[model samples]
Target chain A: MTPALLDAPAEDRLAAAIGEMARRSSSAVAIVAQAGSAARCTIDYGWLSRAIVSLEAGIDAGRPVGIVARAARVETLVVIAAACGRQHVPVAFLAEDSRDLVGQLRDWVEVDDSLSLPAAAAGERGRREFETVPPQVIVATSGTSGPPKLVDHSWDSLLAAARLAEHWHGLGWLLAYDATRWAGIQVWVQALLTGGRLVVPASRDPDVVARALVEESVAILPATPTLLRRLLTSADRGLLCRSGLDRITLGGEAADAALLEEAQATFPQAKITQVYATTELGEVYRVADGRAGFPAAWLGKALPGCVRLAVRRDGELLVRLSRDTAEVGTGDLVQRRADRYEFTGRRSDVIVVGGAKVYPKRVEEIVRGVPGVAECRIYGLPSPVTGELVAGEIALADPLPENATPESVRAAVLAVCREHLEPHSVPRILDIVKQIATTPAGKTPRKPHS
Target chain B: MRPDVPNAIVTAIATVLRDTGRDTRPIESGMLLAGDLGLDSLDLAQTIVLLERSLGCDPFRSASTSRSVRTVADLIAIYDSAVAPGAS
Candidate 1:
């Protein structure tokens, strides 16, 4: 999301994969898109086959080209499939974030709903082989910790770890990640590869996403831990719990114990799978255990694609893609806790107060246990006394606790910290925020200065 | 001077002491934070931040930086002065 020359381009593997899966049934729905919670649309395999044929004819370029589009749009996939079908590699760019990249891209094509899908000729797409191959499609990293880096992938490489058994038929999957991005592409491809229907919410807003989930009965949800935590505190908390969410996929950031435990409790029936993968390392091993981090025994073990996991002395996990490729530092700090290696926090996110390192993840795990607390963010605040001081922002649970006030919750948070944590690790500055602030990528920023 | 400023300071000190399981007896303005109260430097740092949260300002962080406090009254006086109308 890789290698092939001659006829079929590297990028169209995803479309071909969809074309291949399109043979399962004539009326199989592949995509469910809800724009602005108003326009609900459904695209079947017959439509996809039509769009590919029509769009492929309009493309004349034989080299790589770029398209400025949003993944939420089905047209983005249509154009990408058409370009890939024509053997022209395509690079995707978000409309807003494409300003700085427009001049850099060799051949930029503007993709929107206005680019109509050519009408289907005569009959439905026939039962023929689409020849799914690794077509190199350019995608960018989430740029959570740093600047976004463009990476190349194909359907074969992108969906390498995708489960394609027939049992996945008609499963409703939520496109929680940007359909143009890595995690989002996985959900999109997985839904298409299997006979599942991919659900695209109007927006990432918790209320809208929750409504889409319950309405569509989305079974498979691939999301970041931050989004999961926010959804737990949403107004539709009760509905989401009872929804048909059987598979909860957590990725993007490190899944901490508190978030994992809460997500498990919220979706008790759903099987929680934490995927430890990066844009550079591609799809690595997955953890199904309801724990925070991967198993300790997985260390130095070679996973699929000949990738092995190791840790630096400073606690950063090093992922080596293959036998020959150099190790890629994940920047994720993992600590060994007995049998399992739990991700304490990011190496860059460590809060050092008075020379002692304080992991915000450890502090958040303690704060999240408080009865009234819904979510909490522990960050480092600049201090005249210490280099950095520990500060906490707490967001109370959705359903207010009985006989509980903000004053009582704050007091309980303080008492719990004093009882459990060390003096320095205890947050001196406590704020009961309505909600914990998150980055654009739906991650809690640990540095207050930022 | 506002009576609540010194009162809140004493209450904040007692809250910290009680939370830390330190003995809070014979406490007065004359009591030394380091010796009589057995408040370590780390505890003092925490006290300043807590006071900032409750009282809204850190005296040491504004107007003055080198000012040192030996007793509880000195710490109380620093905050009271900062909260004054003309105080920074």
Candidate 2:
């Protein structure tokens, strides 16, 4: 659907649409929570209706309620559907360990595992009268340095770029992102809006996720490049191929050309697309050509009346969403090639080494192309001679061969880095490790030196 | 103390520095990996991997052991303890 077609109903009418959907498909399976091949639970629309009725008492129109960030939980979805459908309360998904929630969520009531709603007031049956307020959802930005900022969006803004088709209904969508976040919420909204089945993995384990995909026969799989890379290197990669995924959408992180190429080669049967989206910007534009970045012509061009893109003098991407001429700085740094613009890294993540600016993501992308390097993280470290030095921690795809030694492997990786990177851009310090740490949002943790 | 543990650690540290195109100064027990030898976190990690390969065991397998390794002597001590009699 085009953005113009999605603007027919005001944001206030979104709750009414959800209520109508519940009335239409009461017996259809809405969610399937699974761990590996084990089905944890399945909730149909009838159960969802009962859940909404039970949760309605706690929701107030125009108020913001906090849903604790828990993946694959039936109650989490219940709070979302109830708060979004009945009262039109803006839901704020809060990470469990987040420290900023106290100040940001002053008026929000936290809904956790202990939340209890009275049993439908004894004899309540069917749909209750729902107050129609402006539909809103608050999602937190995944910033690495400072506190995560919350971005508010209406249902129209969230679903403006969704491609709603008849065949989308009843297809299974794998939920890999946190449902409260924008990426996770997009998957859930896409499935719920079309009466499709949402497949929620029980854990972040790639094997478990892969098995769940096969067991649920997930058709649509949306994930970050980091998570997808993990799945690709896992032993259960065959399971993902056998799951018969029809569509694979990579987002949340800049998808490099090497990763895009590898994914296309691995999932030959699925249509792979990379989405450039941010929590503050909503859906910007999607690249379906199996390339690293969008075409160069896309710069300074308006996309379908929904998004406009421009690069600043410093190469930071400025995006104008939904016909709004006021462009917002996305903080993403881009490099323009002859015909395309590739995202290099975030401007905030750049490290100044010996007066030369270096993007860790650029170095990481180059180093990742080296054979036997499964995952790696690049960061800046304090140096006495240079202002800061480029450093990297790499996890091997497999243990060193019986005939090979660690020095040989280290030398091989260094050789590749030297060939692709400039002398200063090459990592001065490189380590082979068992694993690289990732943030809660499934991104490489790039902690700057103090 | 294991007689070869110190030699193995020193050799690993030298190789890591040389591969990164840094000066391969002589390593000693008194030298601090970070302060004196200029080895960052990544270099230290590579040194540990090389040491494990040479010694046939990883002394820094446990967090406590890894955390205690600050100097060349400390790293050699970890390897010495790991290879000692009755050590797990």
Report RMSD (Å) for each prediction in the order shown: 6.7, 7.7
Residue-level lDDT of model 2, residues A322-358, one tens digit each, is 5646889998999898899999888877877778898
Query: Please, what is the whole-model Cα lDDT of each candidate in the order they appear?
Result: 0.72, 0.71
- Model 2 chain A weakest lDDT span, ten residues long: A117-126
Tens-digit per-residue lDDT, A97-173, candidate 1: 33455455544554456544223221232322553433355666666666666665654566576775558766898
For candidate 2, list the clashing residue pairs, or say none. Answer: none
- Candidate 2 positional error at A345, Å: 1.1
TM-score of 2: 0.77
Interface RMSD of each: 2.7, 7.8
TM-score per model for chain B alone? 0.86, 0.88
